[model samples]
Target: MEKLKVDGVSVSFGDNEVLRDVSLTLMPGELVSILGVSGVGKTTLFNVISGLIRPSAGRVLLDGQDVTGSPGRISYMLQKDMLLPYRTIEDNCALPLLIRGESKRTAREAVREKLPEFGLQGVGRKWPAQLSGGMRQRAALLRTYLFSKDVALLDEPFSALDTLTKSSMHRWYLDIMDKIKLSTLFITHDMDEAILLSDRICLLTGRPGTISREIVITEPRPRDGDFALTEEFLEYKRLVKEELGA
Candidate 1:
């Protein structure tokens, strides 16, 4: 069964029509990328999916049930890690469980048990400011996972890190996703990042953004680090560029 579905969604803010008939689906354990240039309604689409913004038209469904305009149904992470500097890493990650009615101690314990799985072991008691950029992202992702293990809406979550850190986080994220099998839909402007991390890429284009193309990456998951340097990867990139030019 499809894990999540965006069915013919459209959004408009007064005179500005930001999106039109945008639709996509995520299967279990699938990583899908929304690829578009800036101001192309990528974030707006995510907002609709995350139920923060009810689409002017269309339905958002999770596991076949309509869940449009309902917040807290899917986990969402923005470009920044958004970890609290004052809170301990453990507490930061435990926020989700706590919000859902778990006691503080239980939340901390649960977060600790899952820390090593996320490449975070001994940093639970440390401040967010004390960790490197990559580690902070790990913490943020852990928090996101704790919030909702079913699906995640990531908006350029790794875009803020330096090149090396971003690359490292990419590998880690793929490995973690392999273990957890969380259905993921993310937005990114970086072509390379989209190709490197996605199972399929949805091209959002037009004055009022719509899914102009859906390019499947058949190369397989946990793709080789050097895959980006290959002809097949270049072909996919070329196709994306061609579609964008249309």
Candidate 2:
């Protein structure tokens, strides 16, 4: 069964329509990228899917069950880390489990067991300010996964990082996702990042967002820096750029 099905979704703020007849599906263990310019309602779509906002129209189904307007089933990681300055790294990563009523000891244990996998071991006791930007983002991602949500909604999660850090984190994220077998909806404006990390790309038009085109990346899994330099990858980026009128 499909992991997620977004059917004829529409949203508007007051009289200004944002999304129009937007529909898509994500298969189990697949990573899908949604690419569009700023103000094209990409972030708004994330909000709707993550239950941060109600869609003006349409339904969202998760694992074939209707979860429209339900909060907490889908995990969302935003552009900013949103980490609490007072909380330790381990505590921050444990926030999701804590909210789910897990005991502190249990939550810390779970986070510690997975921290090394995410390159965050040995720094759990440090404050967010003590970690580098990439480390902080990794912790945020760990927190999102700790919630045990089947679907992850990433909204420009690496946009704030420098190019080098963003590239490194991209590889790390792909490895982590592979290990966890997550079904993801990643939103971004970077064509290279989208093509490098996604199983399929959904290109959206500006303003009232709609899927202008969809391209499947037929490359093998665990895409890395080498894949970014391939001719096929460059062609896909070109096609998406043309579709977006860039």
lDDT of each structure?
0.91, 0.90
- Which whole-number lDDT from 0 to 100 does residue 133 have in model 1? 87
- Ten-residue region with minimum lDDT total, candidate 1: 219-228
Write one digit per residue (lDDT tens) for candidate 1, span 186-207.
8999999999999999999998
lDDT of 2 by residue, 1-246 (tens): 999998888999999999998999999889999999988989888888877778989999988888888888888898899999999999998999888899999999999998898899899999999999999999999888888556788999999999999999999889888888878899999999999999999987867899888999999888779998889988988888889999
Error of 2 at 126 (Å): 0.5
* Clashes per model (N, Cα, C within 3 A): 0, 0
- Provide the TM-score for each candidate, comma-separated: 0.98, 0.97
Evaluate model 2: give its TM-score: 0.97
Question: How many residue pairs in model 1 have overlapping backbones?
Answer: 0
Best by TM-score: 1
